[model samples]
Target chain A: QQQVKQSPQSLIVQKGGISIINCAYENTAFDYFPWYQQFPGKGPALLITIRPDVSEKKEGRFTISFNKSAKQFSLHIMDSQPGDSATYFCAASMRNDYKLSFGAGTTVTVRA
Target chain B: DTAVSQTPKYLVTQMGNDKSIKCEQNLGHDTMYWYKQDSKKFLKIMFSYNNKELIINETVPNRFSPKSPDKAHLNLHINSLELGDSAVYFCASSSAGGAETQYFGPGTRLLVL
Candidate 1:
């Protein structure tokens, strides 16, 4: 079982509010978790990532909460801005593995 | 400079036609991969190449083939294109080896009519 499932196919939040997206994986071998942000007509870019060793990782306004035992993770954007509106995808992979299992994806719209 | 780049951002072709999409990476990554995103927004891996060697080949149709002339380049060639082949194809690359951050190309939107 190498699937990563994400919830809330789409989300809408008011500007300056908080946007949260959740993801879960069935593969226990996954050690690295990454989130990606994609804009219309553009490639998906790495937003933030966390490892099993860390419970949480924050970079500026983006934060990732990871639970190793539960095999779940989530992405939180504080003070969400309209510019942050895009599709977010969560993926999991193991060390020395080239294949990355990805979730369905979540489209977050921070309206102004 | 663009870390990853793909040619023919949009392509429209008839079924059964053969077409090729080219990809290049300037990020000096040793590994590269190809992913297909369907109309339903599901992204799936098709093939992966590391240092010009075939590494991962998913359960994709035989009509789809991947070629890597160099470590920084990977191309996808589709023979006998079908209507189901219409989708966005993305090319991504990573540095060092596995479990590394990947850089993606803008993507190529293919429409098989």
Candidate 2:
């Protein structure tokens, strides 16, 4: 069972553009949503996270727009750069869950 | 210093062989986890150990086992090598309790023929 669903398995965007990736989960008990970024041959690092208490949280060029009622959350990278080309994953977990349930993964390519 | 690191970044072995992928974290985190990313790129947790204690063990086969000799180290051992076992294995560590942010290792790519 796929708990979290992410769209557009692969995305290509131009530099200085915004790169967006969306994810949704069926479990309403999920309170924590995090977006992770991974470059080739490296581990996924935490990009941004949302607690569901706020509708939107922005940090510099990264933003996470969350909709609790819609069970959807999207990550927006403003002014995307070619260095941002990598795979991204959206994960969700309940407050008590020890393991994170990750989405399939989205490969983002920012063309120079 | 690296937070979480895994040894043998690339592994290649034959069927019916045995291998081990070692992981260590200098972050002093109590909880460590092993995640496998398949060909489809779906990352899933295989096992988790906290302070050398087994906390979470997913529905992985018995051939796969995790040994935590200490709080900072958790090694995964595979009894039998198979083609289906090929994947990128990641080791991650985190502080606090559940739902905490985790730090991940680069990953160990395993290839079995």
Candidate 3:
């Protein structure tokens, strides 16, 4: 069974527009939430992460909004660019656990 | 330098054959993991090693075996390959402890005919 659920299997956005991806989980033990970006023929790379303690975290144009009570989190790409087009994945894991449960990836296409 | 690396970026073999994928990390991390990404882009963890010790083993088939000769290397060997075994295999590593970042390799694409 998939512990994490992601929406919008794929999305397209105009340049300079905003692209948002959402993910939800049911495991209360999950305390670490991370977003990953993957390009064609490349492995997924860590984009941004947020803990349940904080409601949001921003790094450059990428932001992660987390809601502990709702057991949900989202990734927002501000000023989406063509270079940002790739597959995005949301993952959850316990703080001390070595396993990371990943969601079905979302493909984002940014058109210039 | 590459933080995490895998050998044989692409592999193509016939059914009933045996193959192995090798992974190495130079990030001085104590934990390493193997994940499989299916054609539908669903990623799942298969195994994890901490300090060359098996820490996490998901419900994977016995035909798949993961070996860690040291802290920096983890190799996966599969026997009696089948068509359903085709997928992209990724290797990742991280520091031991709580909520550390994981660095992933370029991935090995395996195709079993």
lDDT, candidate 3, at B47: 94
- Candidate 1 residue lDDT tens string, A1-112: 4399998899999999999999998878889899999998888899988999999999999999998889899999999999999999999999979988889999999999
Q: Count clashing residue pairs in model 1.
A: 0
lDDT scores of the candidates, listed in order:
0.92, 0.92, 0.94
Q: Write the per-residue lDDT of candidate 2 for residues A75-96, one digit (tens) a residue.
A: 9989999999999999999888
* All DockQ scores: 0.78, 0.76, 0.72
Q: Per-residue lDDT tens digits of candidate 1, residues B1-113?
A: 98899998999999999999999999888999999998767789899999999999999999999999999899999999999999999999998454788888999999999
TM-score of chain B of 1: 0.97
Clashing pairs in 3: none
- Residue B99 of model 1: what lDDT? 71
Roughly what TM-score does model 2 have, to 2 decimal places?
Answer: 0.97
lDDT of 3 by residue, B15-71 (tens): 999999999999999999999999988888999999999988999999999999999
The TM-score obtained by model 3 is 0.97
Model 2, position A74: C-alpha lDDT score: 95
Instruction: Return the TM-score for each candidate structure.
Output: 0.97, 0.97, 0.97
Candidate closest to the true structure, highest DockQ: 1
All candidates in order of DockQ, best leading: 1, 2, 3
Please state what fraction of the native interface contacts candidate 1 reproduces.
0.75
Model 1 chain A weakest lDDT span, ten residues long: A1-10
* Model 3: lDDT to the true structure: 0.94
